[model samples]
Target: MSASTHWLATASIQSVLERGGNAFDAAVAGAFVLHVVEPHLNGPGGDMTGIFATADRPGEPVVLMGQGPAPAAATTEHYRAEGLELVPGAGALASAVPGAVDAWLLLLRDHGTWPLADVLAYAVGYARQGHQILPRVRDTIATVAELFTDHWPSSAAHWMPDGEVPGDDALLRNEPYAAVLDQLVGAAEGTAGGPDPTGTAAGRRTAGIEAARDLWARLVGREAEAFLARPHRHSSGTDHAGVLSAADVEGFRACYEPSATVSFRGHTIAKTGPWGQGPALLLTLAILEGFDDEYLDPSTELGAHTILEAQKLAIADRESYFGDTDVPLGHLLSTEYSAERRRLITESASHEFRPGTVPGHPPFIPPLRVDYTPPAAATGAKTGFAGIGEPTVQPDGETRGDTCHLDVVDRWGNMVSATPSGGWLQSSPLVPALGFCLGTRLQMTWLEDGAPSTLTPGKRPRTTLTPTLVLKDGQAVSALGSPGGDQQDQWQLLYLLRTIVGGYSPQQAIDAPALHTTSIPGSFWPRTWTPGGAVVEDRLGQEVIAGLEARGHVVTRAGDWALGRLSAVVRDPATGQLAAAANPRGVQGYAAGR
Candidate 1:
């Protein structure tokens, strides 16, 4: 079973399944295809985080942490000298080490059934032959046409074949990316000596996959080193040079770690470590666990208020304590601490940024920049969608980002949820030979000293790309995730609440109206805060809105289906049953199962 935000991706997963591949193989195929079909949301040069549970391990979930860290040269003093208050959301200078490809390949090598070349074939075919362009992709390209033409000519050359954006539904091809994939396939085949005829298939395939990984690392390292050596115009409206070297790319590798988990209502929810924003959702859930079931029903006015207030408190702690370094998670997730934090949520919306105090470690609050200006083209200019790159940092001082998610479950009860993001077509100048742009994930780091998320050499950015896995009765049950940046966890919480509390199915849970609070400081560039800000789907009804407004919440009505793009897959260990569901808001997501 597979569910993703695109039919093509779902089909790719189905293709893998039909070929007798396992859940991990199907997920890898779907993710690679997403890089082809959803370039505006994610790309080969991005990063990802995955949570998976294998049949052998049962309820023990592991985190595939592919989030790359800053290069050794990236530092607060260096960016300060360049006159940057906050990192530029879209530029080479904002790039971390690229890790998505390696992470996916690693997962496939260990858990998947298909050979490396076989799993990558779907993406290669889409990039070479062609695929229909989504309207959103066309619009995103149009929004950054000026940025491409004036500053990043390489991007204009790559994205615009004839010096113009392609029409919607046009068959789009990235030949250069196809060539890159083809070369990787060749490397794997040469190293593995074709298909394995003996019983040593697993061992031989793993060796071949390692060879392909080395080839890819060397190729990308060379390209990135050469590209960053030259000065380029950044979103900061200044010519800046990157300090990342080929060594940085070659030395970096994605790793696996034990997942951080929290239990509620008899189900254990597992998430990425504190390095990413996954723990914030767990914190929110812990706080909500203190409330009554009536107060937890998000469809009701009382529930929405309670949810929003809990989110604010959790996200505030996210800004203060979570990062690549060791965080005092034990105390924060304790029952006593959650009860203390829950007490802060009263009858009204909170306008202050408040993080809880831990026993040993005091909360470290970064310097908050309430008023900051990002360097976009003039407001009077004719940019169709201002601030289009990564969808991070709204022109209205709000911050958001886009990503791609895929969830899969095989007959063997193996399950995975992955969220890939960062390298968008609009992220940076295209690498002419690579047919993709470098990711700008480093922008998530703070420039202020002493903050947990502060910019440091070789430190992972506190990424917003988080995926979730849940286990019940010591067995893997479900995997789910969404695409919004800061709202990824927030939107997912509503789904979890409805599913666990109201006993809703995956589809019904995702189809329901959603809301997320922006009352805390945003994690993206410019790092602006919106006190008492809450964006809700208008379909949530007038009474809910009025109640929230009456409580002094500043509410913005996003159209009914405009908010979340979540997808999920569930497995029944007892009966060997599998079910899947995807978001319908964009008319692109699909779910496929037998």
Candidate 2:
């Protein structure tokens, strides 16, 4: 079973399975297709985090640490010298070392049955031929059309062919990107021996894929170095040059890390280490575990209030300490710590950013909001990042935010959940030669000194991209994730509550209404906070909304089907059965299984 944000990606997974590939192969194929079909959400130059359980080692989950670190020259002083208080959301200056491709390749090489060429074939076809443009893609390009035309001419040429935004029905093509993928295929083909072929299972555990991985790193490093050398207009409304070097790219590599986890109910939830926002979800679950059954029910007035408050407290902790550096995760996830943090939640909403107090370490509180009001000169230009423009849905209706998520579970009991994001189309200027953009993930850092997420060379920004793996009784059971910027885990938490506590099926849990608190400081560029703010789907009804508002929550209804694009796949090893479900909000999501 497999589920993804787009039908094409889901179908790609099924195609892989039909071709006798395993879950890892399907995941690799689907991930590449997501790059083609959901360009607005992710790109070749992006980053990703995944948690997977291989059939050989069922309960042992591994974290795919594809969250690339900042370029060696990306220092706080350099950005400050460029006359910027906060990192620019979309620009060459905000870019990080690209890592998603290498990470996916690593997974494929280590676990997948198919060769590199087979996995990339789907993306190559879609990019060379044409895929129907998503409305959101058209909208994103249109929003940044002026910026592209007036400043980033390379982007204008790529996204806007005739110097105009493409319509939703337009068949969007990226021949350049297809060419890049083809080159990667060629690299793999060059090493493929008579004993192995691209699509055949004979190539399992062969050197051909390793050769392709080596060539890919060298090629991307060379191109990224060349692109960063050229100056581009930044979100600062000024032309700023990048400091990345070929060495920065070549030195970057993705690896497996031990997953951080916390046991709740009868399950153990695995997350990326403190470097990403996964720990926040675990902490929220810990705090909520202390609540009564009634308050834990998310559909009720009291239950909703409790969940929101607990989320706010846990997210505040994320802002304070979670980062790339060595974190005191043991202390943070301790039972004593959970008890201490649970005391912070109250009946009324707490607008304060209160990170927990460790005995030896002092807490670092980031600026409530890094004043990101656009400069007077750039007023005419669209400010606040591309995908994060004014909320897509107003009280009436609007659409906003973008990311790609995939979950796969095979007949062999292997499962994986990966959330790929960062190098979105609107994140940076087009690297014409590569037919993709660099990720502006460096913007998730604080420039201030002594903070865990402070900008430092070779350190990863505290990324919001997080994937989830759930294990019960020391056996792998499910893999789940979503894509909603800071709301990623917040939405996942709701799904967990519904599925684990409310006893809803994966589809029923995902189809239910979702909400997330914006009261904590955001981790995106132009980081800001909203006091007592919460956005909920109207499907929760007026009574729930009224109850939340009466409890001091600043409630905003985002219409029914306006939030969350989560997908999940589950495996019942005992019965050899697999099931899956996808979000129904946008009609783009799909799920498939035998």
Candidate 3:
């Protein structure tokens, strides 16, 4: 069984599985297809984080660490010298080393059973032949048309050929990207005579994957460094050259690490380390674990209020302590600490940003900007440009380009949940040679000297790409995730509460109303927060809305189904039954299995 944010990715994974591939192989294939089909959401230049439990080690979940560090030149002094107060949300100066492609290749090399060419054929076919352009892709291009035409001509030539935005019905093809894939395959096959003259299939396969990895580093790094060296327009309305170099790309490698886990209601929930926002979800669960089952319901006024308050508390801590540095996670996720934090929740919504204190380690308080007014250039005051930021919820409760998620559970008990994001077409200017742009993930960092996530050389910016794995009785049972920047875990919390505590089916939990708090500082550029703010799907009911508003929550009622884009795959270890579900809201995500 497989579920993904796009139908094309899900269908591709289904084909891989049908052809006798394992969960890791299917996930790698689907992820590459997502880069081709969902260019506005993700690309090869992006980052990804995944958690999986193999059939041989069902009780142990491993995290795939694909997030790359800042380049050696990406220092705070350089950014501040440019007269920038914040990292531009749409420029190469904010770019991190590309990590998604290398990470996927690492997974395929270690755990997959298929050859490199076979795994990449699906994405190569789509990029070369063409796929129907999604309406959202066209809309995103329209939003940035002026920027592309005025400054990023490479982007203009690619996204808006002949100075016209492609219509929604157009068949979009990225022949350059297809050729890049072909080069990778060719590099692998070209090594047939080296190392192993006997021509053994396994030796050839191993040699091929290694060759492809080396070629990706050399080719992508060289092209990106040369293209982004010239001055370009940024979201800050300034022209600046990028700081990334080919050496930064060549020095990075993806690896596996043990998962940080916590038990909730007899189920062990697994997530990445504090470098990403995955720990915030575990902290939220720990706080909510102290409440009664009734208060955990998302449909009722009390339940909704309680959940929102709990989320705010967890996120406040995330802002203060969660980063790539040595976070004292041992105390943060402890039972006593959670109990102390839970006691701070009240019947009324709390507007203050309060982070719990850890013994001997003072929390770093970030700047709490309540509101943001974009510069005229970003706001279209000069050229009719829309606001630019990471694909997340706006202050008005409207969602823009976000991330992609996938979950696969094979019959043999192997399970994987992955969230691949960043490198949207709007992130930076197109690297014509690579047929995609670099990601602006460095915007997640702060310029302050003492913050844990302050921009520094050779350090990863705290990321939001988190995936989840659940286990019971020392066996992996489910894999799940979503694609809403900060709301990813918040939405998943509702599903877990519904299915585990409320006894709802997977589809029922997904189809139910969703909500999240915007009270914490955002992880993207122009970092800001809304005091006591909560956004909810209107299907949560008028009574619940009124109840939340009465409790001092500045509630925004998103239309009937505008909140979450979650998907999940489950396995019944006792019975060997497999099931899957996907979000119904965008009419895009799908789940497939037999």
Please tell me which predicted candidate would have the highest lDDT against the true structure: 3
lDDT of 3 by residue, 171-203 (tens): 999999999999998887787446786578777
258 Cα displacement, candidate 1 (Å): 0.2
lDDT digits (tens) for residues 1-594 of candidate 2: 999999999999999998899999999999999999998888988889999999989889999989888888899999888778877776877777888988998898888888788889999999999899988889879877877888778889999998899976899889989998888777777767545656564453456676667776787778877876777777666668887677777787789999999998889999999999999999999998887778877778888889999998888888888999878888888888999988877778877778888777778888886345756255575443345421223353333346799999988888999998867788777888889888878878888898899988999988888899999988889899998878899889998998888899999999988888889887765677788888899898899889899889998888888878899998887887889999998788999988
User: If both were scored by TM-score, which would come out higher, candidate 2 or candidate 3?
Assistant: 3
Off by over 4 Å in 2: 194-205, 375-385, 388-401
> Model 1 RMSD to the real structure?
2.5
The TM-score leader among the candidates is 3
Error of 3 at 358 (Å): 0.8
TM-score of 2: 0.95
| C-alpha-based local distance difference test score of model 3 | 0.89
lDDT of each: 0.87, 0.84, 0.89
Pairs that collide, model 3: 380-385
Please report how far candidate 3 places residue 227 from its true position, in Å.
Answer: 0.6
Instruction: Kindly list the per-residue Cα lDDT of model 1 for residues 98-156, writing each as its tens digit.
Output: 99999999998888878888999999999999999998888777878777888789889
Model 1 CA deviation exceeding 4 Å by range: 194-199, 375-401
- For each candidate in turn, the TM-score is 0.96, 0.95, 0.97
